[model samples]
Target: MLVVIGRIGRAHGIRGELAVDLRTDEPERRFAPGSSVVCAGRSLTVKAARPHSGKLLVTFDQVADRTAAEHLRGQVIEADVDPAELPEDDDAFYDHQLIGLRVARRDGAHVGEVTGVLHLPAHDTLAIDAEGREILVPFVAALVPEVDIERRVLVVADVPGLLDPDAAETVTPPEGR
Candidate 1:
């Protein structure tokens, strides 16, 4: 399946190079020269790449000038990557993989189930289905310690203020169980 790798930014120079807002953490592997990428359902080849400031500057073989690069602005870059080739690390995960996983606290209290993953610049957020209420949990190390995908559970570290602080103080279990 194709995964979003980055988004085309503005044209960087008079050349075909365009600024890109990278989505993947491992750009060196995803956007390297000669890599094939898909954008707007069209295949494109990476001719060159360079780091500019905090963003990436890339040139595609089909794009010959600033005018060509201008047309690519805001287009999302995607790649058909094999999931197994992804970095062997616990922290790395695809957005779709986290969906529907049960979300619980370290104390074994059930909080909710992961419904979706929100991608933000600073960090990713987990959308939890909590008692019919949506709870957004920041997918960070300190708050989210473990992701047991095999058993389909996410272990969240105990942090009093991370959830609804005021409600947590007065929370009472529902009468059913």
Candidate 2:
């Protein structure tokens, strides 16, 4: 499956190289030379790639000079990744694997489908398409009890005020009544 590895940032120097913000943990190895990648719906052959600080410097065979590289900025770079290479430890689920799974409460109440997974700096949140509304639930052990990938279902313990927007907010008393 096509997994997003990085996004092309700005053109680097006068060369055909482009700055890339790597999304994958193994960017140094994934974006190396001779690796093939897809960007903006077009397949590109990697000529050279090296890590620069927190980002990656990449040169594609299709890109030549700053002008060509500029066009690719903001485009996401995707590559065919082996599912087996992904982490399989407990409590860790790949975002792609979580998609389309049915979400239910521990009491067996159907909530919705797993539509998306948001990776925040603080924590990862599961986006459940509950009926018409999207419910953002934290992927914590206390909240998410089980993730059965083979069954395509995730069992979560219903936390009070988790899905209700009104319940999430608190009213402040008037200062001068």
Candidate 3:
């Protein structure tokens, strides 16, 4: 099956290179030269790839000029990836894998169910639906200690006032209050 790895941005220069907003962990490997990715339902092979600022500069074989590249703006780049090719790191997991995990505290307090995974510049955050409330739980080792995929459960750490604000100790009261 095809998995979206990146989205093509505006044309970078006159050489048909476009900026890529990455969704994958290894852009260098996924967007390497000669890599064929489906863009806008068409196969666009990577002619070249280079680092540009914080984004990736990618040239497509089908794009020969800036005007041609412009037409592909906002196109999602998808790859026919095998599940075995996914990251093997114990801590690393795909978004699809994390969704639907049952999130609970170490004390067995059911927090919520993971609805989605958001990847920010800093880290991935788990979007949880907890009793009609949307709770954003950071996907970190300190906060989330266990992830049993087979069991479909995520063991959250016991941090004071982390999962519940009322549980946090009042270090200092408000100055006015």
- 13-93 per-residue lDDT for model 2 (tens digits): 988899888767667666878889999999899999877877789999889899999988888788887776564355556
Q: In model 1, which residue pairs have backbone atoms overlapping below 3 Å?
A: none
lDDT of 3 at 84: 56
Q: Which candidate gets the maximum TM-score versus the true structure?
A: 1
Off by over 4 Å in 2: 82-95, 104-109, 117-126, 136-151, 155-162, 171-177
Query: What C-alpha lDDT, on a 0 to 100 scale, does residue 86 get in candidate 3?
Result: 58
Deviation (Å) of 51 in candidate 3 = 2.2
Clashing residue pairs, candidate 2? none
lDDT of 3 by residue, 14-100 (tens): 989999888777787889899999989888899999888888999988999999999998877888777655565667677777889
Model 1 spans > 4 angstroms off? 67-75, 83-86, 158-162, 165-177
lDDT of 3 at 158: 72
Q: Score residue 129 of candidate 3 by CA lDDT.
A: 87
In terms of lDDT, model 2 sits at: 0.82
Our model 3 lands, by Cα RMSD against the true structure, at 4.1
- TM-score, every prediction: 0.75, 0.71, 0.69
lDDT digits (tens) for residues 75-162 of candidate 1: 8888887865654455787776788999888988998899997765566799999889888889998889999888999988767756
lDDT of each: 0.84, 0.82, 0.83
